[model samples]
Target: MDIYSKAIKVFGKETQLIKAVEELSELQKEICKFLISRTGNVEEEIADVKIMIRQLEKVFDKEIIQKWEEEKIKRLSKVCEVVECAKKN
Candidate 1:
Protein backbone atom coordinates (compact mmCIF):
# COMPACT_ATOMS: atom_id res chain seq x y z
CA MET A 1 0.00 0.00 0.00
CA ASP A 2 0.97 3.63 -0.53
CA ILE A 3 2.29 5.74 2.29
CA TYR A 4 -1.02 7.52 2.80
CA SER A 5 -2.92 4.26 2.94
CA LYS A 6 -0.36 2.83 5.28
CA ALA A 7 -0.55 5.90 7.46
CA ILE A 8 -4.33 5.71 7.54
CA LYS A 9 -4.23 2.07 8.51
CA VAL A 10 -1.79 2.75 11.30
CA PHE A 11 -2.72 6.20 12.62
CA GLY A 12 -6.11 7.11 11.17
CA LYS A 13 -7.13 10.68 10.19
CA GLU A 14 -7.44 12.16 13.67
CA THR A 15 -4.00 11.09 14.79
CA GLN A 16 -2.64 12.05 11.40
CA LEU A 17 -3.62 15.68 12.10
CA ILE A 18 -1.54 15.57 15.25
CA LYS A 19 1.26 14.06 13.25
CA ALA A 20 0.94 16.85 10.73
CA VAL A 21 1.17 19.47 13.45
CA GLU A 22 4.28 17.78 14.82
CA GLU A 23 5.83 17.60 11.38
CA LEU A 24 5.11 21.29 10.81
CA SER A 25 6.69 22.13 14.14
CA GLU A 26 9.78 20.24 13.15
CA LEU A 27 9.91 22.13 9.89
CA GLN A 28 9.64 25.39 11.80
CA LYS A 29 12.53 24.38 14.03
CA GLU A 30 14.62 23.52 11.00
CA ILE A 31 13.90 26.93 9.52
CA CYS A 32 14.86 28.62 12.76
CA LYS A 33 18.09 26.67 12.84
CA PHE A 34 18.86 27.71 9.30
CA LEU A 35 18.20 31.31 10.19
CA ILE A 36 20.43 31.20 13.27
CA SER A 37 23.23 28.76 12.33
CA ARG A 38 22.92 28.46 8.57
CA THR A 39 23.61 24.73 8.91
CA GLY A 40 20.15 23.28 9.39
CA ASN A 41 18.74 20.29 7.51
CA VAL A 42 16.04 22.34 5.85
CA GLU A 43 15.67 20.06 2.84
CA GLU A 44 15.06 17.04 5.02
CA GLU A 45 12.57 18.92 7.17
CA ILE A 46 10.74 20.20 4.11
CA ALA A 47 10.52 16.66 2.76
CA ASP A 48 9.00 15.50 6.03
CA VAL A 49 6.47 18.33 5.92
CA LYS A 50 5.63 17.51 2.31
CA ILE A 51 5.04 13.90 3.18
CA MET A 52 2.68 14.94 5.94
CA ILE A 53 0.88 17.27 3.55
CA ARG A 54 0.48 14.43 1.08
CA GLN A 55 -1.03 12.32 3.81
CA LEU A 56 -3.39 15.15 4.61
CA GLU A 57 -4.42 15.43 0.98
CA LYS A 58 -5.86 11.95 1.19
CA VAL A 59 -8.40 13.14 3.74
CA PHE A 60 -9.09 16.71 2.56
CA ASP A 61 -11.02 17.89 -0.43
CA LYS A 62 -8.49 18.57 -3.14
CA GLU A 63 -10.53 21.27 -4.84
CA ILE A 64 -10.70 23.38 -1.71
CA ILE A 65 -7.04 22.73 -1.06
CA GLN A 66 -6.16 23.91 -4.53
CA LYS A 67 -8.20 27.06 -4.08
CA TRP A 68 -6.52 27.82 -0.78
CA GLU A 69 -3.11 27.20 -2.30
CA GLU A 70 -3.84 29.62 -5.10
CA GLU A 71 -5.07 32.19 -2.64
CA LYS A 72 -1.92 31.83 -0.56
CA ILE A 73 0.24 32.22 -3.62
CA LYS A 74 -1.50 35.44 -4.49
CA ARG A 75 -1.21 36.73 -0.95
CA LEU A 76 2.47 35.86 -0.80
CA SER A 77 3.11 37.42 -4.16
CA LYS A 78 1.54 40.62 -2.92
CA VAL A 79 3.71 40.53 0.16
CA CYS A 80 6.82 40.08 -1.96
CA GLU A 81 5.80 42.95 -4.18
CA VAL A 82 5.35 45.21 -1.18
CA VAL A 83 8.75 44.22 0.13
CA GLU A 84 10.32 44.90 -3.21
CA CYS A 85 8.69 48.33 -3.40
CA ALA A 86 9.93 49.15 0.08
CA LYS A 87 13.46 48.15 -0.89
CA LYS A 88 13.29 50.54 -3.86
CA ASN A 89 12.12 53.44 -1.65
Candidate 2:
Protein backbone atom coordinates (compact mmCIF):
# COMPACT_ATOMS: atom_id res chain seq x y z
CA MET A 1 0.00 0.00 0.00
CA ASP A 2 1.02 3.60 -0.60
CA ILE A 3 1.45 6.42 1.89
CA TYR A 4 -2.13 7.65 1.67
CA SER A 5 -3.59 4.21 2.26
CA LYS A 6 -1.17 3.52 5.08
CA ALA A 7 -2.03 6.89 6.65
CA ILE A 8 -5.74 6.22 6.50
CA LYS A 9 -5.14 2.82 8.03
CA VAL A 10 -3.19 4.35 10.91
CA PHE A 11 -5.42 7.40 11.45
CA GLY A 12 -8.95 6.80 10.24
CA LYS A 13 -10.54 10.22 10.85
CA GLU A 14 -9.61 13.74 9.89
CA THR A 15 -7.92 14.80 13.10
CA GLN A 16 -4.57 16.26 14.12
CA LEU A 17 -3.18 12.74 14.28
CA ILE A 18 -4.26 12.13 10.71
CA LYS A 19 -2.47 15.23 9.50
CA ALA A 20 0.67 14.41 11.44
CA VAL A 21 0.65 10.74 10.45
CA GLU A 22 0.16 11.58 6.79
CA GLU A 23 3.23 13.80 6.79
CA LEU A 24 5.28 11.16 8.54
CA SER A 25 3.98 8.49 6.21
CA GLU A 26 4.97 10.50 3.18
CA LEU A 27 8.43 11.00 4.62
CA GLN A 28 8.78 7.29 5.17
CA LYS A 29 7.81 6.59 1.60
CA GLU A 30 10.48 8.97 0.36
CA ILE A 31 13.15 7.43 2.57
CA CYS A 32 12.21 3.91 1.64
CA LYS A 33 12.20 4.76 -2.03
CA PHE A 34 15.58 6.39 -1.85
CA LEU A 35 17.20 3.58 0.09
CA ILE A 36 15.71 0.85 -2.00
CA SER A 37 16.49 2.58 -5.27
CA ARG A 38 20.00 3.73 -4.47
CA THR A 39 21.68 1.16 -2.28
CA GLY A 40 19.44 -1.92 -2.52
CA ASN A 41 18.29 -3.44 0.76
CA VAL A 42 20.58 -5.30 3.14
CA GLU A 43 19.00 -7.08 6.14
CA GLU A 44 20.63 -5.11 8.99
CA GLU A 45 20.37 -1.95 6.87
CA ILE A 46 16.60 -2.45 6.64
CA ALA A 47 16.42 -2.76 10.41
CA ASP A 48 18.07 0.65 10.74
CA VAL A 49 15.51 2.02 8.33
CA LYS A 50 12.72 0.63 10.51
CA ILE A 51 14.23 2.35 13.54
CA MET A 52 14.21 5.65 11.66
CA ILE A 53 10.57 5.08 10.74
CA ARG A 54 9.73 4.71 14.44
CA GLN A 55 11.48 7.99 15.14
CA LEU A 56 9.51 9.66 12.37
CA GLU A 57 6.28 8.48 14.01
CA LYS A 58 7.16 10.45 17.16
CA VAL A 59 8.37 13.56 15.36
CA PHE A 60 5.08 15.35 15.84
CA ASP A 61 5.00 14.83 19.61
CA LYS A 62 5.11 18.27 21.22
CA GLU A 63 6.94 17.03 24.29
CA ILE A 64 9.73 15.71 22.08
CA ILE A 65 10.10 19.02 20.27
CA GLN A 66 10.07 20.95 23.56
CA LYS A 67 12.73 18.81 25.14
CA TRP A 68 14.90 19.01 22.02
CA GLU A 69 14.67 22.80 22.03
CA GLU A 70 15.38 22.93 25.76
CA GLU A 71 18.50 20.83 25.37
CA LYS A 72 19.61 22.89 22.36
CA ILE A 73 19.27 26.12 24.33
CA LYS A 74 21.21 24.72 27.25
CA ARG A 75 24.04 23.54 25.03
CA LEU A 76 24.19 26.80 23.11
CA SER A 77 24.02 28.87 26.29
CA LYS A 78 27.10 27.11 27.63
CA VAL A 79 28.91 27.74 24.36
CA CYS A 80 27.76 31.41 24.31
CA GLU A 81 25.98 30.66 21.03
CA VAL A 82 22.65 31.95 22.21
CA VAL A 83 20.96 34.46 19.98
CA GLU A 84 17.35 35.55 20.24
CA CYS A 85 14.40 33.22 20.10
CA ALA A 86 12.03 33.85 17.22
CA LYS A 87 9.40 36.44 18.11
CA LYS A 88 5.76 35.70 17.54
CA ASN A 89 4.79 39.28 16.95
Candidate 3:
Protein backbone atom coordinates (compact mmCIF):
# COMPACT_ATOMS: atom_id res chain seq x y z
CA MET A 1 0.00 0.00 0.00
CA ASP A 2 1.07 3.60 -0.58
CA ILE A 3 1.75 6.21 2.10
CA TYR A 4 -1.68 7.76 1.66
CA SER A 5 -3.36 4.40 2.01
CA LYS A 6 -1.30 3.67 5.06
CA ALA A 7 -2.14 7.01 6.57
CA ILE A 8 -5.84 6.48 5.95
CA LYS A 9 -5.70 3.03 7.42
CA VAL A 10 -3.91 4.25 10.54
CA PHE A 11 -5.95 7.43 10.95
CA GLY A 12 -9.47 6.14 10.17
CA LYS A 13 -11.90 7.43 7.57
CA GLU A 14 -13.68 10.04 9.71
CA THR A 15 -10.44 11.67 10.75
CA GLN A 16 -9.19 11.72 7.18
CA LEU A 17 -12.48 13.11 5.93
CA ILE A 18 -12.26 15.95 8.42
CA LYS A 19 -8.66 16.55 7.44
CA ALA A 20 -9.69 16.72 3.79
CA VAL A 21 -12.31 19.35 4.62
CA GLU A 22 -9.71 21.34 6.55
CA GLU A 23 -7.23 21.18 3.69
CA LEU A 24 -9.86 22.27 1.18
CA SER A 25 -10.82 25.18 3.46
CA GLU A 26 -7.18 26.24 3.69
CA LEU A 27 -6.86 26.13 -0.09
CA GLN A 28 -10.01 28.25 -0.44
CA LYS A 29 -8.62 30.79 2.00
CA GLU A 30 -5.33 30.94 0.13
CA ILE A 31 -7.13 31.47 -3.16
CA CYS A 32 -9.19 34.30 -1.67
CA LYS A 33 -6.07 35.97 -0.31
CA PHE A 34 -4.33 35.68 -3.65
CA LEU A 35 -7.33 37.17 -5.42
CA ILE A 36 -7.60 40.15 -3.05
CA SER A 37 -3.94 40.90 -2.20
CA ARG A 38 -2.09 39.05 -4.99
CA THR A 39 -0.11 37.22 -2.34
CA GLY A 40 -0.60 33.94 -0.50
CA ASN A 41 0.80 30.39 -0.35
CA VAL A 42 -1.74 29.21 -2.89
CA GLU A 43 0.56 26.62 -4.46
CA GLU A 44 1.40 25.08 -1.10
CA GLU A 45 -2.27 24.96 -0.12
CA ILE A 46 -3.11 23.40 -3.49
CA ALA A 47 -0.49 20.71 -2.92
CA ASP A 48 -1.93 19.99 0.51
CA VAL A 49 -5.45 19.75 -0.96
CA LYS A 50 -4.24 17.44 -3.73
CA ILE A 51 -2.59 15.16 -1.19
CA MET A 52 -5.80 15.04 0.84
CA ILE A 53 -7.79 14.38 -2.35
CA ARG A 54 -5.54 11.44 -3.14
CA GLN A 55 -6.18 10.04 0.31
CA LEU A 56 -9.91 10.60 -0.27
CA GLU A 57 -9.77 8.74 -3.59
CA LYS A 58 -8.24 5.78 -1.79
CA VAL A 59 -10.86 5.91 0.95
CA PHE A 60 -13.82 6.22 -1.45
CA ASP A 61 -14.70 4.47 -4.72
CA LYS A 62 -12.06 5.74 -7.08
CA GLU A 63 -13.87 4.42 -10.13
CA ILE A 64 -17.01 6.35 -9.29
CA ILE A 65 -15.00 9.49 -8.70
CA GLN A 66 -13.29 9.03 -12.05
CA LYS A 67 -16.63 8.65 -13.77
CA TRP A 68 -17.86 11.89 -12.21
CA GLU A 69 -14.69 13.67 -13.27
CA GLU A 70 -15.08 12.44 -16.83
CA GLU A 71 -18.68 13.64 -16.94
CA LYS A 72 -17.72 17.05 -15.60
CA ILE A 73 -14.92 17.35 -18.14
CA LYS A 74 -17.32 16.53 -20.95
CA ARG A 75 -19.72 19.18 -19.71
CA LEU A 76 -16.91 21.70 -19.48
CA SER A 77 -15.82 20.88 -23.01
CA LYS A 78 -19.28 21.64 -24.27
CA VAL A 79 -19.24 24.96 -22.44
CA CYS A 80 -15.84 25.79 -23.92
CA GLU A 81 -17.11 24.97 -27.40
CA VAL A 82 -20.03 27.34 -26.95
CA VAL A 83 -17.70 30.10 -25.74
CA GLU A 84 -15.39 29.56 -28.70
CA CYS A 85 -18.29 29.68 -31.13
CA ALA A 86 -19.50 32.92 -29.55
CA LYS A 87 -16.03 34.42 -29.88
CA LYS A 88 -16.00 33.60 -33.60
CA ASN A 89 -19.42 35.14 -34.18
Q: Name the candidate that leads on lDDT.
A: 3
Q: Residues 16-67, candidate 3, lDDT per residue (tens digit)?
A: 9999999999999999999999999999999999999999999899999999
The segments of candidate 1 whose C-alpha lies over 4 angstroms from its true place after superposition are: none
TM-score of each: 0.80, 0.32, 0.96
**1-89 per-residue lDDT for model 1 (tens digits):** 89787997798899998999998999999899999999888999899899989988888987899999999999999999999999999
Candidate 3's displacement at residue 62, Å, is 0.6
Better structure of 2 and 3 per lDDT: 3
Q: How many residue pairs clash in each candidate at the backbone level?
A: 0, 0, 0
Give lDDT: candidate 3, residue 26. Answer: 96
TM-score of 2: 0.32
Task: Give me the displacement of residue 61 in model 2, in angstroms.
Answer: 9.6
RMSD of each: 1.9, 12.5, 0.7
RMSD of 2: 12.5
Worst 10 residues of 1 by lDDT: 3-12
Report the alpha-carbon TM-score of model 3 versus the true structure.
0.96
Clashing residue pairs in candidate 3 (N, C-alpha, C atoms within 3 angstroms)? none
- Per-residue alpha-carbon lDDT of model 2 for 47-80, expressed as tens digits? 6555444444554565787799799999988666
- Give residue 86's error in model 3 in angstroms: 1.1
What ordering of candidates by lDDT runs from best to worst? Answer: 3, 1, 2
